[model samples]
Target chain A: MPLIKGDQITEDPWVYADDEDELPSGDVVVHLERWEKDKDSLRSRNGKLGLILRSDQSPELVADDLAAFDLIALDFPAFKDGRAFSYARMLRERFAFEGEIRAVGDVHRDQLFFMHRCGFDAFEVENAAVLQDWLEAAREFTSVYQPALDAKQSVLRLRHHTKKAAE
Target chain B: MYRYDEFDRTIVDERVKQFRGQVARRVSGDLTEEQFRPLRLMNGLYLQLHAYMLRVAVPYGTLSSKQMRMLAHIARKYDKGYGHFTTRQNIQYNWPKLEEVPDLLADLATVEMHAIQTSGNCIRNVTSDQYAGVAAGEIEDPRVYCEIIRQWSTFHPEFSFLPRKFKIAVTASEDDRAAIRVHDIGIQLVKNAAGETGFRFFVGGGLGRTPVVGPEINSFVKKKDLLSYLEAILRVYNQLGRRDNLYKARIKILVRSVGTGEFAEMVDKEWQFIKDGKYDLPQDEIDRIKAYFAPPAYETLPATDATLKDKIEANADFAAWVKRNVAEHKVPGYGIVNISLKPIGGIPGDATAEQMEVVADLAEKYSFDEVRVTHEQNLVLPDVKKSDLFVVWEALSASDMGTSNLGTITDMISCPGLDYCNLANARSIPVAQRISERFADLSRQHDIGDLKVKISGCINACGHHHVGNIGILGVDKKGQEFYQITLGGSATEDASIGKILGPAFSYDEIVDAVEKVVDVYLEHRAPGEAFLGLVDRVGLDPFKEKLYAAH
Candidate 1:
């Protein structure tokens, strides 16, 4: 899998361990059930820690434990299933989770812009062919209407300032 | 007539660019059709039965003359010299090629219009009363809030891909001209006990395979918390709405499964977390948007126009048109003129490019450059002066746009059935045409007054047959086409889904069946009683007895 971060394709150092698989040594991401079952063991292990949540899994389940992990990967069971988009926004704006929110599973170039705006900073796509398109798609819109987790100024705020300046 | 500011202009231009790239990728085979369907639908492009149909959003049913002219241009250049004004108050061009859609969208964006969210499983184009600002005794103008919701829902990241499509409608008057009760989320502008204006919300009302009138979720929400509350409802639906079954995907189903009380509680709980956050609308923005909808300039004049009265006395045809098609305006000496698209024995909502150009000319000259599209598939000049009524009627009559059936039997709403839609089971336009021809006599139509006959080609109810006083739904029995009739549905403030009559009527018998139902109503009704009132007085038993007697 290739990872899209910012405008470039970068090496992904995180290893995804299946639910029944043995934990890898360095910077390993485990499923929610695995992390829940072996919380103490994984917490005491070496290297950085990460957790993966399925589309059905709510971020509120791990709200208290967000500080323990360095990354939270949200799964898009299907591109059409937009639960993770809400989960990502909740993690960033509601729970105030500062960890890296990565989007995995069925991620594509067309949805990358929306995914990024929903607070997913990194995406794991199936192919490297989509990296350039992903970069362009993420920067497709120069202005947006509503406030999101991203730091971009909304058009409403801009209009407010413009009104003040004219006054 | 809200002009696009720089921010609005930039967002629309960028969206066009983005869609152009998507279309290029699709055409070059980089993206497959399965992957491109949702993308195209989100931009209001649908692969219909014959060709690509492009639905252009007429925000809250409001249009300027410039925009109307551009629509005529698109109709002539891209489609078959005509366009269909839909029940959602939008216009659809039924025959544009896939590759030409980007340029069509570009042309639309130049005039501050686009087809964004006219389809797809996202928050669709916000609809409102066609008589929004001009209607007498309106609590407040609903377009300001509609514009607010439009901007908020456009490209919203969190809830773009929900379980199913969402629709929202707004109205500012007690008369529910916008049909808010059948929408997913209906907002009514009302005054609270303190004499302050706010919104009363109805959640999860829709007409589809399953028809349910949305229940009022809140009596009154403060002005500032409107978006926050809407966000709360969308978040709850996006997270919990059923996605496994396409038929059960609408918010109406979720609201039904959990009951309105529980659903309202869930929304309230969700709102507790985000109500005071960034989603709370600022007062300044509301004021700014409201400024665009302020009352236009007018000279002091009497309530009645002497020239109009004399002309009405001189010409019986003009008098009939005035009596049927004109509505009272809040301002004195002004009238709200309804332009009926359902001409005698013609396609119900179809308007030719010539008609569009004529309407644009009339709107520019007489109506202060504003036009409106109604959910009933009609057009309105919302601010026509009484003095200019004769001239406007003459111009419209010249273009074959004049009709004296505003709310009569011939003012029927029929969807583009098997003729254009792949989802239709039977042809609806022919049946509507037959019904119109049967009731072609204006005197007879006036006798059976204020009858709404809505026809849907299928159970999806795009023509809003579920809420029509006389509803017709087309079905396929084995290989042949059949029509099912429902009576006693009303889409006004008192909303209810129609009841189905006993059996199905074949293609040939459906029009006669409708006539029989009307005959029953006319015979049994007291003087001046409308169809729905008669049906309410005497339930479906009388209609069923009459309709099934021959069987």
Candidate 2:
């Protein structure tokens, strides 16, 4: 099933009609009403293990609360905020979370490589065709630097040390 | 003067090949500007306002006559027949196409030169006393340690990505000619109480929009622990420095935000783990590096140059050049010659391809073919046989490369500024040109001797304005460019940041204001006192009183 929109099944054993706006795909429905995204909801919620979080909320707090989740949806209210990049890296390197970190809004193909290097795995791009452009980011540079999210060397450190016999 | 062994030569050659590939890839669209930016910068290729500029490193500012001639030839052929020697002891060709850089690097490689780490957020070209081994001052040779640091820092795995670029300078003499205090990491080579050679470490010294004097982190760093202490500092900075804002990412900012005391503590903690680690310098390695800098054979001769003295006394121009450009050497009758890149009205660090070739040839003939780039953006032919000084000076004079404004007011450290740098607001070279013209009289320059004037186009102190005895910083109000003047800045052992006189001035008024500052110093100062010494005792009050008292 597509992670963006797949099904809406209630516990009443009834299948509801899907809305025009695709409902995010998940087996569990986490109703994180405004202020209720506390540690309890984070720790107790048990389903497809995908929970969406607001951008305004502290990703650091959410990262600490998160134990085992398959997907993290970090919302983007406006395009310019770069708090998410740090949050993603913090989750990936700091918290050692090995799950899909998705960037949901105000993102384009140009920010894909830097975004991915900062540890955003899958981009919730605007259109399906945008995915192709996002892939172009990987082709931009032949090497990586400083062991980013991708296991590679930084351009500055990309000196291919010619091998010599070890002492 | 470090000789390139087979390994070093191979490494430099391989570097050229890699940079060539990178250039080709960039031209073929395999690498975009963003992708190619770091690569080109690491190779010392910068695309400025007018065209591309290539900065060729002069390790410890040492070069030979053959190398100098090669530089001159390259300048005449590839560039605008001139090259600018930078404040960091390197020569820059102001115009070259991106495609031509590979061949340039290859040509330089033949002469044992490369521009590795001249830019980017890595440990930049290590600088030291331009008159390193030849200076009369006693202690140790600064280049030996500089070379050690070069080998250790080159492509160090953990330091490739830092918050910002780093610069390290060392000085061995009592006089701080290398401006060690103005570097990111400055080392003062000294022997300890027990007669053990070591270094005094200074961290966080830098000049930019925010000028700072580095603090002495360690009273003394054992010679063997130089690389480890540096690693500790870099580790602390890399992990903790602010990466969120580019402007505040420099180690200077980290040193500021963390508080030097706390930062020192952090570095101490890190040093505990790596203080005696793998990168320690051994006697063999030190000897190896020292072998590269071992002075050429010298022949003792008379100390007094009666003939040269007579010539200078007869010709006022030669006198002026000799008074400013000649430095004391340890050997009898030998002098270290500083080749002035700043001619009367020429661009400060610009050297022509032909001029480079000429310098190379001169190095081979007169000097030991080893040339050094001064931190003041001048070239030095260290270890010139005093007997051959007359001949070298004549050759230099014919080429107009013999301005002799070595420590004078006209030997300006100027940034590319608005003419080239993307970060600058006003043009620096034109102001520098006007000042040079104003001070063109050789007699007048001598009369007002031993002054350091530095100019920067913007707040980014690429010109190192904070250390200039007379400093000029250009700023923009609304959209128009205006220049500010400061006095009493010194970069020696008693380093202090320059103080602004008052309000900013029009471009035309700025030069006159500088003239006024000098005139004030000339009027009130006692005999034989240098500008910096005079500025120290009286403070900036006399100059400031006269300066701001203007309309």
Best by lDDT: 1
Task: Give the whole-model CA lDDT for all candidates, comma-separated.
Answer: 0.92, 0.74
> Model 1: per-residue lDDT, tens digit, B401-432?
88999999999999999999999999999999
TM-score for candidate 1, residues paired by index: 0.98
List runs of model 2 lying over 4 Å from the truth: A1-167, B309-316, B537-541, B548-550
Task: Name the lDDT of candidate 1.
Answer: 0.92
For residues B323-345, what per-residue lDDT tens digits would candidate 2 score against the true structure?
77888889888888888988899
Estimate how well candidate 2 is docked, as a DockQ score: 0.06
Task: Give the i-RMS of model 2 in Å.
Answer: 9.0
State the local distance difference test value for candidate 2: 0.74
Docking class of 2: incorrect
Worst 10 residues of 1 chain A by lDDT: A127-136
lDDT of 1 by residue, A1-167 (tens): 88888667889999989889788789999888988999999989999999999889999898888888999999888888988988998898888888899999988787888888899999898888867777888888888888887778888888897779999
